[model samples]
Target chain A: MLIFIGLGLNDEKDITQRGIEAAKKSEEIFVELYTSPMPNINIQRLEDTIGKKIRVLSREDLEEKSKTLLELARRCVVAILTPGDPMVATTHLALRLQAEQMGIKTRVIHGPSIVSAAPSFAGLHVYRFGPPTTIPHPSPSYRPTSFYNTITQNQARGLHTLLLLDVNHEKKCYMTIPQAIEQLLEIDKEKILENRILVGIARVGSNKPELR
Target chain B: MLIFIGLGLNDEKDITQRGIEAAKKSEEIFVELYTSPMPNINIQRLEDTIGKKIRVLSREDLEEKSKTLLELARRCVVAILTPGDPMVATTHLALRLQAEQMGIKTRVIHGPSIVSAAPSFAGLHVYRFGPPTTIPHPSPSYRPTSFYNTITQNQARGLHTLLLLDVNHEKKCYMTIPQAIEQLLEIDKEKILENRILVGIARVGSNKPELR
Candidate 1:
């Protein structure tokens, strides 16, 4: 059996009770925190809470060596813990497909995700939000502008856009709200983004969550 | 203080640990289950689990008699329990805004939402989903065909559409997957929806969740 559990947002305690139960029952646990920047995540605290030693999987480990993890699931109950809702990322979905192909039964324990949390915290109606977009930090040779187009399309429909900032956990780099705004300004050659109200949220699902 | 607590997708146990803590600490609890159809929702069971007598709110109560609820919040900690994520409904968002305007503090305890769960269970990529649409049961002189248009718009962008079937809790009428698909077929005069694959999920977040 292969179980995919979401760790929710921020710290260890944000995990749902159902998630904790699954973690306790699983014979093997693998956590992937590198996909997103969870600033308050403490591996030690999470391990202590679940009473299990979790093998942390890097991006390469998940993409290239997933068969090793699948092999374990073939024998015993294996849980893959991820920040936010599991399978929100394409890679995680692909991994689940691979597990299914190998005749492993799979289940998902959903958690509170930023996709819904952001708008709720911002006092915005979730129904009015169009499909969300992501803003990635530009590289020297390549910069994607599809996010800008998505924002414009949503704005034209009188809908709000939730822009997710890019994260590189390996390099300890995260794109801040200010950096995201700056990128938007740089990409707004058509001047459609001018004077638009933007809400910035930090540490959502935490006790002292901040919104501006 | 007023807190909006999401009960998640299915039953009382689907409420997160954080949500349970908030419910325990709350002086008064109000639940509105009319907005969505949660097949496993049992008000008596939920009240028993929380160890509190919950005042159930109807649409008229929430929209017309909101001040009465807000008055309770002014004096004590009041928690409003909602199915799925609390603020997903626009009416809930409006109530929160009203509370804020009346000098009441509000917070949200996020939970597992169908917005994320539907795609995850369907084995479809979450990022590939466009803005979600609702399929309401047709009434004389009030057949809404916009949902069909929305589906076509999403399909044009090579994205999938998550269609939420409308429910009338007071009438105990929930739109089934067959009803929704039949409605879609009737409204697709443009013939854009023919032969498109539709995934139906039942009892999500339950022990016997079924997806096809």
Candidate 2:
């Protein structure tokens, strides 16, 4: 059986009891660190807390050599763990679809996700906020202009946008609050007509999470 | 202080380990029924699983007579149990704001919510979903044409709308799949929409959930 477990958001304890149980029972555990990472915890802490030695998989290992993971799932109970909710990234969905084609039974264990937690913890109405937008790190050579456009459109309609910053999991590069604010300010500089109150959320699913 | 604990989507076991621990220590535990309900488990079963006596609070009790709940929070650790993630509702946010005004410390323990669970279970990309729209039950005297307008607008922008069925906690009325479909068809009345695929998910966060 192929099971996808979300490590929730912040720390080892952020994982649900059901998710932890599935990870413990799995014959092989694989943690995908490409998408996102728990801000307050690391692989060693997760292994100690989960009581399982989890093999880490990079983006290339999962996407390029995915046959190895699928082959393992064909016979044993393989648990694929991702930060936050699994299937948020298209790569994970591709993996699940591939597993299904191989006649492997698949199951997903839901975990606490920032999509809902962001609005809830920030004291914002879930329904009032519009669709969320991701903000990647800006560079002089290449800036994620598409993300800026999405946030601008959402703001035009008087909707709040949950901006997910870009993260480089291999280098462990996470977009911090100051960097996100700087990127937004830079976009606002080119487009002077936009003015919207942006909310910054960090360490979601943790006690006393930083919210502004 | 009043601590809002989301019971997650399905059964009592879906509650996080932290939520269960908090419930065990709380002097009074109240479950708000108006916002949402755990479909797989009832009040009694939840009480039995959590090993605590729970009181179901109506919308009136929460909105009009919250003083009792507030007072209980001041005396001991009071848990306000909610289905799905707590503070997903506007009233809960208002309650939290009120608690702040009264000098009561509040803490929100995040839980699994449908906003993230739906896309994960449906195999849809989380970033692809636009602003979700709720389809309310049409009234005899009032025909809601705006619901269709929202759906059309969302489609025009290449965004999928999450059709949340109406929840009538006062009458124990849950808008099911068939009922919601009928309402949408009645509102739109378009021939091209009959074959449009719509995913139905129920009992999320359980070991075994239904997906159609």
**What DockQ does each prediction reach against the true complex?**
0.59, 0.70
Please give, for residues B81-150, the per-residue lDDT of candidate 1 as tens digits: 9988888888789999999999999988888888888887788766677788899989998998888878
- Candidate 2 per-residue C-alpha lDDT over A1-212 given as tens digits, one digit per residue, 9 for 90 to 100: 88998777776666666787788899999888678776665778668767889998878978999998898899899999887778777788899999999899988887778888888899987766667778776667887678777776776766677888888877778888898888777777556435656677877677767877
Q: Which lDDT value does model 2 have at B86?
A: 91
After best superposition, candidate 1 residue A89: deviation in angstroms? 1.0
Candidate 2 chain A weakest ten by summed lDDT:
A189-198
Report i-RMS for every model: 1.6, 1.5
lDDT of 1 by residue, A6-115 (tens): 88877776677678888999999989998877777888988898899999899988999888989999999999999888878888889999999989999988887888
TM-score of 1: 0.94
Residue A208, candidate 2: alpha-carbon lDDT: 68
Q: What residue runs in model 2 are displaced by over 4 Å at the alpha carbon?
A: A42-52, A189-195, B42-51, B189-195
Clashing pairs in model 2?
none
Model 2 achieves a DockQ score of: 0.70
Instruction: Name the runs in model 1 displaced over 4 angstroms.
Output: B42-51
